[model samples]
Target chain A: MEPGYDLPAMIGMTEADVQTPALILDLDALEANIARMAAEARAMGVALRPHAKMHKSADIALMQIAAGAVGVCCQKVSEAEALVRAGVGDVLISNELRDGVKLARLARLAGRAQVAVCVDDAGGVAELAAAVAEAGTGVRVLVEVDVGAARCGVAPGAAAVPLAQAILAAPGLTFGGLQAYHGGAQHLRTEAERAGAIADVVGKVRQTLAALEAAGIAVPCVTGAGTGSFRHEGASGVYTEMQCGSYAFMDADYGRNLDAGGAWTSPFRNAMFMLAGVMSKTRPGHAVCDAGLKVMSMESGLPVSAREGVEYVGASDEHGTLADPGDVLRPGDRLRLIPGHCDPTVNLHDWYVGIRGGVVECLWPVTARGKHF
Target chain B: MEPGYDLPAMIGMTEADVQTPALILDLDALEANIARMAAEARAMGVALRPHAKMHKSADIALMQIAAGAVGVCCQKVSEAEALVRAGVGDVLISNELRDGVKLARLARLAGRAQVAVCVDDAGGVAELAAAVAEAGTGVRVLVEVDVGAARCGVAPGAAAVPLAQAILAAPGLTFGGLQAYHGGAQHLRTEAERAGAIADVVGKVRQTLAALEAAGIAVPCVTGAGTGSFRHEGASGVYTEMQCGSYAFMDADYGRNLDAGGAWTSPFRNAMFMLAGVMSKTRPGHAVCDAGLKVMSMESGLPVSAREGVEYVGASDEHGTLADPGDVLRPGDRLRLIPGHCDPTVNLHDWYVGIRGGVVECLWPVTARGKHF
Candidate 1:
């Protein structure tokens, strides 16, 4: 659905044309964020492969590419398919794949885009090799190294070399470099802690690179870094591609991260908000809004009211109760809520209704919103 | 999408023939549950209007109607629209509406089905009345009484009367009875606590009913109750409708509720499971699966491994890490995961692939999966 196409026209326009419980993206803030990240990557001479998992919209992926991003990284094969269908030429799935159906989907996707995937085990390599061999297509395989996340990925250093060799020995797989990512360290709260975490990651990457070199293998791409630790990874001279996703639409969680100046300056501004309306104000201190647990993700924390002197206290399936409204908030009052987390919150909506200057400027379908499989 | 369609045919089986991690519904268990609830409602001599919000599918609504349920209750206008499109004749949105666009949508939906909506304030009533008048359709408006949920709905007793009178005075709106639902009481750990909470709710509903009767306003339909306290509400002589959606696909959270035998017996059996394969298991004491926070909702809690001896501990975007997998997991091993919460977990998937007896049987597209509006 395009902007103003399937949606109901604004019945009565207000200061903000759309009603509450609407997903709103600040286009100016978003562009500035893309430019800032692109400039940082350009300065460091490292390729910026922005992760599309954060926004999950092809329109934003195109904007990132237009801003000189090398490619967009997708977490799921379906996401990669959606991006490729949207005309993204270069795509890399930074997550491991083992399902045969998904591998076949990836092989089909590789026909249209420069598709690469991460692998931490021999079984995954064998599966990818089989799929690629059957399709008679070349797919890049990156050996993911465990930096600190303790999730997927093999151990760094000597353990990663065998995985790389296995990928090179596979029938139709190309040996891409390491995916050394520490997801936990990205939200370390302080610059020193983030830098310390990244330093440890850089040491692991160095060890893996030395092991590959000793074995007479050229490591092509060492890609890893998020919006929180992209600068550290870029300055380390290890990673060739930085996969930062949240830099496009910063949320309240990112706003808490500190910068080098120690003045709590976020690299990006809060650009996404769920516009909700005050549906009922029967009580004196509380007013219920249309947005709730269904509308916003409550994993990080509850959404903070963007308006002054208002706070979100609780949420149900269909309604969010706001606390301590300074004035009597009648029904139809629009409120902008800054989500605690952006990624999961964006996944909850079907459309990203872009609002600029209070008019319905554009609407972009969240093509990968419910692509869980 | 139906059973034995697309993927199921490719897998060469019916829904009853698929392996575990595939969502399965025992026809016997489901029919027994429907019959049990209908018998309870018939014994109580009250209308059984089951809520469609639990299972956003119209197939379940049709079954509820066949089991002697008067109508189905919906949480959103979009859900009601989908239900009506799927042939549900009568529907009620159990939430307040303030947006004119949504109200217009509701009025349009009323044209196809017997539509009713809850109102908590005068502004909502006025907008709904105007929408109904403009659409040239009569919509039943229920005055929602805040029966301890502390969410939407007006204060009990006289405060609800004015809203009821306003609905009566509206051009194309009829005043339905009070909506006295206590959502918080549904999840009470003990039967005694749940019954006690329902008792308090009954008092409030009685006050509202008496006030309306004294004012000579007809209270045609008094609806409220969830799966947790439906039995108590059915016997209370106040609530005429039971809105229980999760009974169709019982989850781990619901399994915690104690049964009538003084033992831990789930009221509804576990029917839904997320089938995920072990993506990486080369590490000791840990194995990662393809299902994660994106695939399954973790808000209620992490999904429990259906097989004995395996425990789910950590999750990332596309991976669920299982710890202490005592000889039950390896790469290529498939496991069924019982989700912590059924609603949000169901919303994550695009298709509910139903498998039974070790074969892929059916694939139901989650038609209203991401319908947040």
Candidate 2:
């Protein structure tokens, strides 16, 4: 019933001409981040399975695959479906699913591509096996060991053995490995802190591996890591696959992470930005931009302005109040905003206006933008 | 390219069978909220203009209009376009637009609907008028006065007079009244605090009105109020139109606002919920649900669990950690989550599964979702 809402910008339009509240991707920066991550994973002797949950764009996922990523990791069945349908061959759902409908979808998706899912419970394994048997497809299953995230998965060591055994015995399912990602360790602020957190995570993963080895089951892969702690996990010897997502589109939160020397110098650069327009500038020392909670998420923190002398102070539903000390911002002026968090903020937009050399290069649809099933 | 991503649930399906991470709208509670808000507005002697930005659903906006709302308010040009194309005849963009492309779109949308927009600057008025003239349509224009909201709008008093006069002089534009919204006053916690905040807003609005009157300008309407402080603004007599959006879908943040007796006795009930499944329950005293920052915005705060003895403690990208001291929640179990904020949370979903008597009655498309021009 709805029409006439055009895309934010034309491909050849200048960055200044693009509409406000549009998600902009620096093409050069994104490519550099992808290449760097792929090289780093190769150098560290770990398979790179960049998380697709961050960008949720099939085009970006295909790019990572072309750059030598083994596959991509998604957190939801719907996301995997979106990517696989868009020609992605291998996808690993790095999280667990308990719903039968979702498991059925996952099994059906396995008929099309190489699909692997994580499980931490017997009920989940049973449901998944039923779906896969009904679909007549063999789906890879991984035992999710808690490892330090404490958010999901079975306990560290022996508790995962039964889950792995269940997967091995279930019809139309194969035990892939262990899903041991520690999500909490990704953003520990300091290099020492993140390294320490991953060290603990590696210990838990090793214990789980030893238990599985005792059970005479060979683990194919141990997938986990994030932008903050990927270096530690990549060198941990226990992790065989890295699922770093936000390294592709570094945000203000990741930019705040301290390096080994306690400096903010990181190999990755900010690639994603929210281009906002100054909608109202009537008040002195303050201006309102067209990007706020609706266009950018603020759970981690407020967006950081890319321009000097302007600070994004507060965000309402549709308006971001900027602290313009010099009152230089005027009506219709555009500003680039680095979101606090990449994944959730990227989820808020439909199209990523890819730009390079101050001009829009492409408009990639966030293929799985709202695929939250 | 995605062919397998089906709707979360079909019509007539049971609520328990609906997919996790789906946005559920309790139909009974939603209708009651709409009717009550309409009745309250009638009793308060003010026109109801429910903000469509909250739900972004054309179906919900139509229901509000059927219940006696004069029109609906939006915050973006594309949102107005979406609703207008979906048969919403009258739309008022409650916020300012500075980009020429968006203004042009807004002007064209006015050709198909009764469209009005707010402006706080001379340049905005000029650009809007030009677009309206180019489109050969007359558009209503409102002078937004900063009424205690430091985010946007011109200064409170005599500053509005020149802007209103400018609107009157511009071609294809008719000066409507003032757009004085105190967004920060909406969530003042206690009734006394909210009442005090709105009192200040009313005073500023009155000053602006007096200035406009002294300048021999007549204001046809004054629209701006929200769910939290609507009662105060409704009784102010200066605000002729109330723009309360969250009353139809109360959130955890609004649920925390206290009444006049310093108790949590709100007239509105929460009709909206995020139905998530317990994906992992391996750890004692803790469980992880399949809803997180992707499905729900946590800027205001984390979502409050609808079940007793289960508390939502933390959120990651795709998992919500619940503190289940009793360990009653198990894998595949469902929990209804009341999001901290309603507007942005609703934007994260594609469809609203409307339930009544524990069955899916309707699937409403969030028509204007992500239409952030």
Candidate 3:
């Protein structure tokens, strides 16, 4: 229904005039955030592979690449395909890929670009190799190492060796080094916690690197670090790359993290916002907004209202309750909500109404949205 | 990207052959659910206006209407617009709508078919009335009452009179009585709790009806109730129309609702499922699937694995952790997850792959998806 609808007709409207329940991107904040991150990565001598899973937009990936990022990282093959089709020549899927269908798509996508993927299981190597052979192209395989987050990936030391060896054994696969991402570190509240988490991960990476070198394999790359701990890992001599994605779009969860001085200051500015309208304010201090869980992600926590004197208390399917002090918000008043989590929250909208100088600069379709497969 | 990609190329394929992270609707379960709800509403003599927010699909609405439903109720104006475009007439937007943009679109929509909306604010009435007058059409405006939700509604009794009177005073607006939905009772867990909650709401509705009648305003309709507590409200005689959604697709939250003997048995079956692929199983007694928060709604709770020996323990952005006891699921094995909540979970996907006899029978686009505006 939206394909036929005039979704892009709001291109020239001002921020205040654009329709509510729209995903608004502050282009100035976005450019500043990107430039700062690129400068930091270049200074630290680490390649920046911003995760596409965060923005899920090919347009954002292009901007990052232009800002000196070494391609992008995706969590799914479909996302990689979208980026590749949109002319992103280099991509590293930070997550593991199995299942014949996805592997074949990844292999096909490799023909369009320099495609790489992470692996933790030996059985997955043969399937990926077979798909690559069918596609008549090769894919770089990074053996994922579990540094902290007890999620996908092999244990950080010698456990990843067998997977690396299997990738080397495959004819159409190139054994790229370790893919170690400590996802839990991205939400560490304090500087000490974020730094300590990355420090331990660096120690494990050292052990993994030594083990791989002893096995007569050259460890080419060690890519891992998120928005919360990327600075820590960027300074580490052992790390080769920082996969910071959320730095491009600061969320409420990341905003909660403390800096070195124990103050709430980050290098990045919050560029992503959900524009909602006040739909009801019948009660004295109570109000309801049009955006809710279907439009905003509430995993980390509820969105912090950008408006003063108003508090977002709760949300249902399509209604969000706001505790407005003395009814500050009436019907038709637009409110900006800083989402707690950017990745999934961005997934909720179809178009990002890019705003610059209070004017709608562009309307980029969230191209890779709903591409879970 | 999906329009070019063959997403439904697996139409005649079995469940194992279907793609990962797809919203699968079991045709058998769906038909049975529709029949059961239609039968129950018939027995109770309540007009069934199943909420389209649960499915957000006009195809499902047409099916409900075919099975003896008085059209459907939508929570958002865009949803109602899509359903009307698809030829499902008589839509009652069960939530309050403000803002000129939405009201104008809604007014335009009312010209296509029978459109009704709820109002809780007098200021909203002026704008809605302006839009209706411009459209040269009239709309049934139901004065929303705060029926224990603590969300978007005026107080039930005389407090609702001013809004009702305003709706009556507005030219091109027809006062359609009270929109009293006890949202809390939907998840009250016990039969007595749900029944008691609705019983209290009934008393409030009676008072509101008296107040409206005394003010010379005729309360034409009183529509409320959901799949969880629809039975209780339908029997309450005060509720003339039932807005029960989720009966077509029962989720884990509804599955947790207890029946007469405190056993987990609702008349409806668990039909809506997120078909996920086991993407990783590197650790013993643990596995990871391809579906997570991006695919299922975690608000009601995390999804439950349909497989007997496996359990979904946690989820991240793009992956869900499964505690597989006994080393059952391997990478590439597909499993269905019963989502915790049906409404927002359905909002996560773009297409619903309808399955019948272990084969993909149809693929319906979630047409109104991401239509929050």
Candidate 4:
């Protein structure tokens, strides 16, 4: 089925004519970011698997594939199903899946694409094996070790060995090595802190690899890294695959990350914007915009204004209050807002209006939006 | 168009068989809340126009209208259009519309339904008049007065007169009285604070009405009140309409609100839940659920767990971390999570699995889930 309405913009319209509270993509910057990441991954001798969880657009995924990305990484089976249906040939379910229905769906989806999933428990491995056997499909399974992020995965070193052995013993499943990711360490404020976190992650991954080797299991690939700390992982000589998603569309939260010189990292530019229109300017020092928490996720933080002297102060359900001390904003004025976080914010919209040279270039559907199951 | 996939669950399926991270509604609690609000509105001698911006479901709006509501209130033109297309007879755009494209759409939408919109500027009045004239349709225009929420609306009292007069002078427009809403007042921690804020709102609305009366203008309806402070507005003797939306599906944020006796309010029960499945249980005192920020909004706060000894602590893109102090949760275990905020949380899913007697009875689409433009 298609979306309930038309696309947010046409192919030839100007940016000014595009609808408010729409996701706007800078096409020039997006292409540059994609090319840069591909080149960097090649230089580091690691396979690039851009996470589709950030953009959720099949068109962008195809572009990354054409630019030498191995495949895309998604978090859920439904998301992988959407992307696979849209011709994303290879997908990695980066997190664990324990529900039987989802496992069955994943097993069926594996028939259409090269599908893999991560698991930290033997019970999950058994359930996945049953689903794959029922569907008569072969699927890859990765042993997820808790490198640093304490939220998911089993304990790092020897804890990954049992899950690997379980996957190897299963008939329809293949051992796909370890999934080691430190989500919290990706957002460390300083480069030194981030490097230290990745150093710890590399040590844990090495210990897991030693345990697998001792068990006579040959590890194929180890994947885990994000936009914030991919450089460290790429240079570590241990990570075989990189799963960086948000590098293509940098956000305010990432913009706050510092480099070795104590300046904002220059590897990527902000390529996506939440384009909002001022609908109310009644208050003297404040103006209300059409974008709010419904249109853009504020869980990370409030969006940063692209224009100087105008700061986004607060957000409600349907309105964003701007601290426009200069009182320069008026009704119908459009503003490009840098979202605080890229992933959940992109999930809030249906389409992305790609613009270049101030003109609409393309429109892509967020194919995997709301596919959280 | 239909959604990209099939419904999460079929009728007659048990709650346990439904997909993870799906929106579940308790039909009994929903019916009770609707009946209670309808009776309260009747006793208060005011019209009920439940806000569709919260639920965004035509089925619920129809249920309210069937019970005795005059119509429904929405925050966007696209939202009103979606509801109207779904057979809702009447809708009010409770927020301002300044963009010409949206104004034209709203004007065209009025041709098929009883449509009204709020405005605070004379320029907005002119634009609405032009759009209505172009479409050859009439729409009701309410002068939005700044009653306590400083985000939108003009200053209260005399500031509303010129806009009301402009609406009277415009073609294809009718002056529909004042839109006086105190959004910030609704969430005040204490009952006394909410009452004080609403009292101030009543005073401002009263001043605006007196000014309009002095100018020989007749006010037809005074609209605005949410679930948080609707009691104060209902008893204010100034508000003619109450727009309580969350009362239909109470959330954790609203559950924190205190009554006059320093207890949780007893008027509404939580009728909605985000049904999730535990995907990982590797840690000693923690488990990861399939639902996270992508499935449920976390701007208001983390979701409240329905089961004892389990608390939703942190959320990433696709995983919810649960603090399971008793370590009772295991992989594939189901959970009923009360969302932090009802409105945006409902916006994250495509369908609502309505449960009655532990079985799925109905599946209602969130008709206006992403109609933010």
Candidate 5:
């Protein structure tokens, strides 16, 4: 299968002239976000490993690496393969690798690049070690401690010891560190809630590290944190690397998070937008845009209109009904939508059209897109 | 961008040997669905124009066409382009075409196949007329009527006549009647609600046709309906064509609709399944699968596990938490998920692996996948 869109049609066109349902990236805002996160990480004396799973593009990953990122963190083996294929180094699979086919690919990638993966099961450790030995490659293994996400990873403290020891016992695997991503805390809304969540995560990390030390298991690094609570993790002295993904494309959901003063406190501006065209205005109350659930991620929530006053009301499979009260939009009129979640929304499109001053400056192929397996 | 998984890694592999996070299609179930729909349409004496937007695969479209379909209805011009490019002829853009680039491409496609598109505006009619004339091809026009969906289309009765007249006035265009799809009626829990919704749709369609006939416009065809309400529209005397998609890949949401007897009455069995592998079972209550929102469509609802007693609980970006109470499933166990909505779920993957007797039989590329423009 080939991606239908090879190159962008918005090269010489203005932002208004660009095609509908295109992923538009504001380079200025993106650069500002990259710089902001890098500066924050540097000040906190922690290495930044921006989550490549959020963007799924090596171009953005390279940009972050160029701006002082230690590496990129992916959730899938195929994602790691795609990023490494694009010449990125020091890639980490932040999630578990159990499928033999994927583990074999990860082993192959580990031979070429500095590859690391998280493991929560001691039983699966031997399986991964076999694949690593088959490929004649060394893979760094991280013992993932369940830090309140309740999704993946072992329980904190003593529960991580067996997994770390299993990795240490394996010939082709090195017991690297721990992955303590408090995923549920990322979007806790209030700064206190987010701070409290991270505080709990910090306590768990300390507990786990102390338990591992009691068992005479030396841990090198501890990686965890998303864009929503990266500040707390960066400030924590125990966290060595912060894995913030959506810092570059601060979406509507993250934009809704409040600070200590109860105001939206995202340091990043909206760098990502899904461009849609008003396809119909015949209806009295609402106008339909060409983009909807197929292109935009509605997991967090529906997209918000970039223009003020116009509200995104409803959506079908292929159309978004905008509540156009003043009839400001009509057929052929273009609009930008701030997606609720940037990662899944980015997964829907093939190219990210970078727009600056209403002109298309860069187009990056979502190289790892649709690499679900 | 080139697709990462260019071909099936499960050609000779058994169901157990197939890779994780793959789309597995039951060929027997799919064939049964196609035959059932075709039989239903034939018995009702209405032409079947299965909506290509659901599958977006030319291969499946060809199978649909081969199984006694008149043609296929696509929600986008780019989907039609990809389908027609793959040799499936007689394509209809079921949605409105207003964008110039898309319209021009649609016109160019009209020169190759029996092409038609929907239009609800007079201004867009003139624009499409220019493109159709430039391409020197006959493009049929369906004046979509707002038959209670409230999303797109001009109002029924007197409102749609002018648009139908506009299409007739344009050169290289033929008035292809009305597209009155009650998309909202498809998921009404009870059969009476669906029947009532279609009755209302039929009334509006009749009113619009009466207005068109009063203006001396002869209607050639009326296309509408989907997997849920196709029986209602097909039985309606006014509807000439049924645009039923998702029949071949019955999803969980569609499976929820009750029949006249208040039973799960879809003649189509669950043909489409999203295959996910158990990556972690370290947690006592729930196990995490490799597939989540990134691969599956959770908009309608969470996926139902195919195995008895196994329930889908929660999801993250890369992990789906499955509540495996009986411990029947563990790490490396493959589970089939009945997707919430098949269309968007199909949009996430690249290939569809056909399984028969628990053996890999057919592998079809989701050729038009991600043709969102």
Candidate 6:
């Protein structure tokens, strides 16, 4: 219950000396992911603004920047503020802001970093403008165009022009570019389907860019793309920036995506892992672990046991049931779990005990882990 | 963003001044829920050990204790630790523990409070005993019987008797009782199914209790039951404590459960609301809000708009789309969203901006919000 009992001290050694159900980050794998994405973006001549929404840790953002990412994209103003405070120079809030209090916070963030936000409405543009004006700061604005994800964003092409115009007209706000992120296309399992999805997205972005050009407006940055479809977006000339987030922590869901050769070849290595301890084996064919629905995200799917011969079958609020391996797993067995969805799963924890070379390197606070607003 | 800002600095202010996308806890409704549950427990003559996994807040646990609950059940050791540190006297960790580190933590927890834990294996009993012996504390251990959930817990009847005996045989661990909680039964939809599910659970408990009694072992407590079927467990004469977590904050999923009259009647009032603002209204039929999958949990389903004529149809990582309430919603319009799942949704926030009478009265830290150990 007293959380700060250093795991190393309690266990009489370092983190590497500890067993499973611990959140471990392969620094090498993480760096490789960052480098690969950066190289891809550099080759494609697109800005690489990695989404901080995926990690929510400033440490990761700094690493992304160091790997030549243009900037970081934050989903919430609070997240942006946290990143900026952590010395992230540029942050694009790839989501709209309506609350005046949040808008004011956005303006403050703009003072510290190169702040840009996405707007899908004329009123949102005006509000951003007003907040920027009130704070006496210059903030950039992007018109969010709905490509295929019918979740947010305005209709593509001409519809986005007016919002861009409003943002341009608003005092203290500059028309930054377009946010053409098709979130749904990112998880299309098959390569052809993913390509087709992004192809449609690219066509929509092209039309939007043409419409803006016709209106005598320049789109400086058309940012969109996730780890799953970054290749498609990178190939498409319309997308100026790729907003890939999950490439850092490749999960089982993303790992299912097929490559061009019709074989499963994940571009990124699995870097994130949840270490769990076997809590119970009172049953003959099952052993219960200490991680469950609350510890891991079951939205995408249940976590796959990293160890061979172990199958994760069920989860309760606090306990996860693992199918018994042929060998007996007693109460003290440690299990490593590769989360199905890394983003939300990370959100469920307070600290990321960063382990490297089997040692407790550091514990990074999930600073924006629960920043819903 | 720097979260603490204007927006009517006190609770019970007009809705116009409240911040959007803030967690609003209706104290009046919460008190009513506590009272109603307490009254029901009193009437049924069952000890109510409300689960802290729902709120994960010590303040709420204290409130439940004040409302005449015997103790509180937590899903994780970290949560139990937090509650015990906050002065929650009788704490039951309704989950298994495998690692010596957690067992040590649990043992330390027993020093301050009446600590009871569930075990489904002999190895778990040994670990608990070792930790308790090391700490020089007597920790109570409950043999978790697998009623029907098949998630955790050992098999009922004879299978549970050995685990019970193991706990009793342990050096520093005392045989507390049996845990026969069926989580999946909580959302059975109809009253009959819910009752049937509890009946099945009760049968399993009866068998296990009989097995223990036949072996000349006295089962001190038979704790089980949830918000969905506490009444059934209470009436079954098999359970001593009811661990219902969600009665404090009834959600859309719970709202689907039917009463004896075959009418959908939620036992508790909807006390938790996610106050979100319409960030975009460029389209005719849709309005985008700043709250989405990352803010609100979508595992159960989309959050239902409290206001009539508005539907939360979809969500992106950071934006929730509300079907436009024709001619009523603008870009800055504030809306209250009743999350589909209150527990996970609440876990996604750091501060519960408790508002009363439309004003922000208190900002309580979700103390164990991300305690995913």
Q: Could you estimate the TM-score for every candidate? A: 0.94, 0.98, 0.97, 0.98, 0.98, 0.95
**A235-337: candidate 6 lDDT, tens digit per residue:** 8877888999999988878877787776443557888888877766655677778777676777788898888889889766667889985756767677778
Q: List model 5 lDDT by residue over A1-373, tens digit each.
A: 1123334454657887677778999999999999999999999999999999899999999999999999999988878888888989999999887877788888888888999998888778988999999999999999888999988888888998888888988999999899999888989999889999999999999999999999999999999998888878988889999999998998999878998876554578999999899888886667999998999879899998988778998877899999988878879888999999898888888889999988988778898997776
Q: Is candidate 3 or candidate 6 better by lDDT?
A: 3
Q: Where does model 3 exceed 4 Å of error?
A: A1-9, B1-9
Q: For model 6, how does the per-residue alpha-carbon lDDT over B71-184 read when each residue is reduced to its tens digit?
A: 899877777888788879999988887776678888988999999998776777777788898999989888888899876787888877777778777888888898888888
Ranking by DockQ: 2, 3, 4, 5, 6, 1
* DockQ each: 0.49, 0.69, 0.68, 0.66, 0.62, 0.54
Residues B155-183 of candidate 4: C-alpha lDDT, one tens digit per residue: 98898999999999998999998888888
C-alpha lDDT of candidate 3 relative to the true structure: 0.87
For model 3 chain B, give the 10-residue run with minimal summed lDDT. B1-10
Measured by DockQ, the strongest candidate is 2
Order the candidate numbers by lDDT, best to worst.
4, 2, 5, 3, 6, 1
Q: Which parts of model 5 are misplaced by more than 4 Å?
A: A1-6, B1-8
lDDT of 1 by residue, B1-373 (tens): 2222123222435432332223444445566677777887798887888877666777778988999998898877877887788889998888888776778888988888899999988888888888888889999889999999998888778887888889888889988888888888877878888889999999999998888888888898788987788888888877777777677677777777775566333546676777777777767788888777676667677888887889989877667889954656777677778888778776665566644555654556565666666
Clashing residue pairs in candidate 5 are none
Compose the digit string of candidate 3's lDDT tens values, residues A70-137. 99999988888877888889999988777777888888888889999988888888888899999999
Q: What is model 3's DockQ versus the real complex?
A: 0.68
The runs of at least 3 residues in candidate 1 whose Cα sits more than 4 Å from the true structure, single-residue gaps closed, are: A1-15, A260-265, B1-28, B259-265
Please state the Cα-based DockQ of model 2 relative to the true two-chain complex.
Answer: 0.69
Number of the predicted model whose lDDT against the real structure is largest: 4
Interface RMSD, per-candidate values to 1 decimal: 3.8, 2.7, 2.4, 3.0, 3.2, 3.2
Q: List the pairs of residues colliding in candidate 2.
A: none
**What are the per-residue Cα lDDT tens digits for candidate 5 across B1-373?**
1123444345656887677788999999989999999999999999999998898888888888898999998888778888888999999898887777877788888988999898888888998999998878889999888899998888889988888878888889999999889888999998888889999999999999899889898999999998888878888899999998988898999879998675554488999998889999886668889989898878899999998989999977778999988877778889999989999988988889999999888789888888887
Of candidates 5 and 4, the better by DockQ = 4
TM-score of chain A of each: 0.95, 0.98, 0.97, 0.97, 0.97, 0.95
Lowest summed lDDT across 10 adjacent residues in model 5 chain B is found at B1-10
